[model samples]
Target: MEESLPEALSTERIDGYVDLRSYGAIGDGRTVALIALDGAIDWMPVPSLGSIPVFARLLDGEDGGAIELAPSDPFTVTRRYLPGSNVLETTFTTATGRARITDALVTGVAGRLPWLELARRVDGLEGSVHFRWRVAPGTRFARSSPWVEQTTHGKVIRIDGVTIAVKGSDHGPRGGGPRGLQGSFTTSAESRHLLIVAGTADEPLHLPDAASTDRTIDRTIQNWQLWSSEFSYDGPWADAVQRSALALKLLIYSPTGSIAAAATTSLPESMSGGKNWDYRYAWVRDLAYTVNALIRFGLREETHAAVSWLLTTIKEHGPELHIFYTLDGDTPPEVELLDAPGWRGVGPVAIGNPAKSQLQLGIYGDLFVTMRRYVEAGNLLDAETGRLLASVADRASDAWRQRDSGMWELEELRHYTSSKMGCWMALDSAVALCELGQIPGNSERWKSERDAIRDWIEKHCWSEKRQAWVAWPGAEELDASVLLHAPSGFDRGKRMSTTIDALREELGRGPLLYRYTGAEREEGTFVACAFWMASALACVGRQEEATELLDGLVALGNDVGLYSEMMDADDHSFLGNLPQGLSHLALITAAITIEELSR
Candidate 1:
């Protein structure tokens, strides 16, 4: 039997936001939630990752809602993911006793569940530990008002068409009108208690009993371990590489097999705000890196799924590829600014991204590189996919001459050097694939255009004064993105090697590097750019320097081995979204490159 808690334990929120570093994630493949070190689940989107968040306390504070569970006394905390799994085990030590909490967005006996379920299991390790818990669903970012309704089944919070039910241990307020379900219980030594939160949108909710939910949580842990065991990579930094692979897996949308760039949106790239943009969509560039990393680790299922998803999505909407696509493999909606106060009052919490309509020439290389890698991995492209790639190559050849937004997706269009290299890579891949009889294309035209792109870059992109290939012709700014082509085989000569030093001297902050010359003024250093530098150094025969830089960068991740889209140079705090796919993908690729080069 459980006893009542004496008082409440509050999770301190500085200006209504928890530090990004203090959060760990749990997902069921369809959606992910961020839980703070204090045991408050502050962010979770229901129905899907791109769907409206049922808990947005991360963005809107207490008004946005959260599911909070913590010890009722002053306590210290320590936590880690279970070995080879995403299941989080957090231990809380109070003055009188110690208790442990195991959390997960559960999976099913077969695979992912038909409905969403978040399970939290509590065990008392020693003495008596009282705990306070609350299940509060938010206003969907102030878009809807939710209230408790008593149905024949039980008590549930309803907002719009979504129904959320909290089950298991009961105490505190009998009916949580609008404030949501709340309770308290004390755990004695050797005691176990379970709490399960289940939800469904426009469908009947699946309320699994405490026994089944507990069993499912265990099964989810085993499933994650089983998935982790399938991949083999005994390279340097193997632990960090494995952790990054698992983080990337959380961002993969299970239904469509497309991966989101990050699990959260509008987390900000700068504390002062305005740089916040939604990243819950899939980008061709990010997917390419993910595919390469997965391929290198010998993980075939996700690699094939991601490749198939990209080609199929492009085929349906292509001839001209958008920079990104929604998780459902469609164009993203127009950006919508929400009414909620952003994280730490960084306003303009947003949904959808505007970059979808931008003309990013880099996508040509991204698509072709993905196809080439997939084919090289003993995978076959269907007839239609091969035809589709040929058309993409032709489009790349013609579009190469046009001034457009480069990989950075800037509004001021220019002939960014990275864009030219991307076109060069695309055409080169197309010619190679044609020679391999993998795709139907005009080899002569592709080769001619490919050489022209190289000539154009050689003549215009290189800046002797800066001793680097500048961001664009007539501009003296350095861009870290140019480092990518070193690994792409576009350049690994003296020019590329000199450019690496130029970038480090100009853009490096400790081990982290900004994306471009002025990026430090507007945002934190881009996390993926730092990893790219490591890979570029390795590719350019500076493996020793590359390994050293990689070691420092690897130490930058939070305790849980997760990285954000960017990191502040001054404080080393995370900026932008959590568990950034590109950052993790870049880490995986860099480790693989260094491993391959060492041999």
Candidate 2:
């Protein structure tokens, strides 16, 4: 075994920033961890989504917490997920030896675990390798440090009522117990070691026997493989679709069936302030997209559960629904500007989203889309939910005339073409559901309202100057959101084809597409918009071009096929929250469209 540090390993600062793309992720339904290529768990929210992060180095860098395991000597790292699972395998190759590290946030025996468990396994591939690891939890986003104590299991760290126990490898003689959990151990070929971090706050920490814990990891892998086998899409990009489906599954909070928008908070959408927002909570629009994608993948259980949860929430807060809610259907707390230097020194790292109060007007349509799919999947709508649907449709008919924030949640209120179309879609889907006798509603009024809304968009939303459906009425600037209309059935003719061409001319960055015309220069290309463009291209009969675009967009995903909310235009680095639900949903939708076109 090598004892000396190689040049790169010696020089590589454990606290330095790694490209977001250089990370893979593992989750256990409740939360996810961002595992860098060098074997560091940088960002993770334990106990639940929206909870205080225990390892937030992705945001606070040196001051944020991290759990890192890597070879003592310098090494070149390559990583991937275990096939069809979120278990990440990062392999390190040095001049002397090679080793592979597998990371997974494993579920317990009953399917969904009661506690958060991170299982890390190391296997010696060649020669002999010396690996060092430490559990140095940073101050909780610089707010406070966790109190650490030595326990029989190993080390117990407590932060905000959450208890995390760090257990060293059982395969080797343990060096450090609870204090710091740092040490180096050597492994030869055919040798293996398992390290576990189990967390709990509400209940007593469950430190299962070493053998049982190891079995739990194996069972978690088998569970994921089983779920992946159920995916029905064997399409143009089957692997990407399967990966996206798995990513979406990670975003689902099993207890309540709410799907979060993404896995992290305070990850910047752009390089700096105001663009940084928390995405740990579930947005109705993103959830709708998730439900649609889940249904498409033949995941009816999850789709039905999510839709049922969302409908119950909406019914509880009827007439006026916010854009998003907590996983338990509660209003999110006020936005807090954490006193932490954000990623790349971007300040004003916000916790809660202020977009909650903004009138996005799109929620009406988003919910209806889910409801439509729910019914189409042979799920019945109870009378209460049916009445609630009618109420939402009526509100959409009345509220479409008001000035509110558009889909982007911009501060300025305007008649956003996309929002108008969203209201139209709300009525459109409501009418269809009513006509199908799935819901009780005045179909005549809904039909008339949607017809009028269509006429309004055709008259005001269309831009003669650009000869496309602009972002807002009479505005020359275009948005990638307009591409959504193709799948929503807003436009499917030559006009849509021309609109696609116009958008590509205006906002396209090769295969990646920006959210709007100026977004490429300001922020990165949106992962969702690129897929929407691909779907639009397919809808407009450009099957070959659409497939090409879809392939390029699929290539942008990280090595394990995970996507973030946005992508850096120049370097293609992942930006914002990871395992973004909308992005994965769009990818699945694009694959489905391509497959249908091929058929």
Candidate 3:
């Protein structure tokens, strides 16, 4: 028997917008769709996660496209991801009856399909229930207008170069003008129905058969379970860790093996707006954390794929690494503002990320640390990749002295303490790799520079007045990013221990923590930083403190264990993008670290 969700999980919407906390995600490696508790797929980019979205209601309300499916009458809802899979099963109990909707962005037998397919299966549980559903593909965020045409395959929707087909519905395929299709039906006990939305761009659309598509949904569930079973984790918060791993899996782009920072772009980090930025692109820093966590979980295929993708992309596009890359492993394009009224009237829904061009010096450390972790896991680095890493170490040796954006990617250039520490970590990893015969580099220079960076940080970055590592030299602000070095093996002594307490005291609001001092004035507390604090606490031998902190943080996720980029420290509402990869990665690593420390 399926378990029902707790009463706290509400299906209510505020002013036409569902809370970010109420969204669950389904994906097929190429793209992800955000489905609300009310059974509306409010956000989904077609063809790829980075592509223009066909369903944009999450940002633009009714003007944005959405596939709305639910009971026609008032209903209460309960839902959960099918055990060990990303497939979601939502149960709606209306006044008259109950119905179950199983949703998945179906995968092919060989892996991800060449075209996009979203399948939702409705199974009547008890009594008779009336259902209504609409397939309204938005105007691609005002980029292209959609039109319905009658073909031999039935009514198909076309928007620019893309074609869409909806299958399996009773009643006339009523057109909602250029918006798309709608239908209503009634289901009896034990009755089953399937709806498949298949789409393609710059190619012919594949209209799926109802029977085959129904079977494929089961196949996708089985595939997810098989993958999830292979992950080797049995630590505390195991369920949360497993769910996070599954969430992160959806963010990993299988075509080029790049992991997205988050599934959606322009979900605000703050309700008032301007903090919105596109996060569909993969950041090197986030990838490094993901690779480290994947290695810990004993997942080899994804770890190797991610490492290979980053190295190949860097070798082709380097010697200098950009802060982040498109899922196809190219530099991201410039930011474009959409005309859509953002979520809850937050304006300026953006497309491309501007941070791609920013000088985030910390990426050098992110790159080398990823390679080091891979090498330590018994993988051999090819000579070409080794030379590439060696050159990056040489560059970091000098770049440490320059002022630029730190991991936060701020516009103002400053010698951020974390950026300097990142450069130190890069040189440190380069030296270790050299010792392991994994890379041929000037080890002596790397060692010298590594010590020099440590000396510089110790001399200037530490703030005696605050008894912590300041955000930058001579600045009084504290950055939570400095806690990352504890896991990097940079420091586990009194300084780091004290820094942890100081960060919590100065920046923490309950279990959450701002990214840095002054950040609270701008946005909500960062989700990843809270987990980082737990990991840092564990690294510093505060196992009990870390465990308690971890307990609170894990419970903060949505009902299905999905975390966004930020959370309101006061209201506990979700902010920023949904199913944030870095937040999940941090949770995995923190749990693993706590388990290791306990042992």
> What TM-score would you give candidate 3 relative to the actual structure?
0.98
lDDT of 3: 0.90
lDDT-best of 1 and 2: 1
Give every collision pair in model 3.
none
Model 2 is weakest, by summed lDDT over 10 consecutive residues, at: 1-10
Model 2: per-residue Cα lDDT over 1-599, one tens digit each: 21122222222443467777766778998888888777888887777766888788888887788887888888887777788887877788888888888788888767878888888888889998888887766777776667667666555777767787776554422444432456567778878887778888667988745566768778989999998998888867898888888888888988889988988877778885568888888899999988888877788789878988888787777558989989888778899988788876776678899898899887788989889988897888888888888887878889988888888888889998889889989999999999989788579998998999999999998877787898888788998898888989889888788888899898877888888767766677888998999999888888999988888888777667889989877777778878788999999999998788778
For residues 93-179, what per-residue lDDT tens digits would candidate 1 score against the true structure? 898889999999999877999999999999999998899898888888878888888888778888888888888754433555565
Candidate 3: residue 527 Cα off by (Å): 0.7
Q: For model 1, which pairs clash?
A: 268-576
* Residue 247, candidate 1: C-alpha displacement in angstroms: 0.3
Q: After superposition, how far is residue 513 of candidate 2 from its true place, in Å?
A: 1.7
Ranking by lDDT: 3, 1, 2
Q: What number of clashing residue pairs does each candidate have, in the order they appear?
A: 1, 1, 0
Q: How accurate locally is residue 263 in candidate 3, as Cα lDDT from 0 to 100? A: 92
How many clashing pairs in candidate 2?
1
- Candidate 3: misplaced stretches above 4 Å? 1-9, 169-172
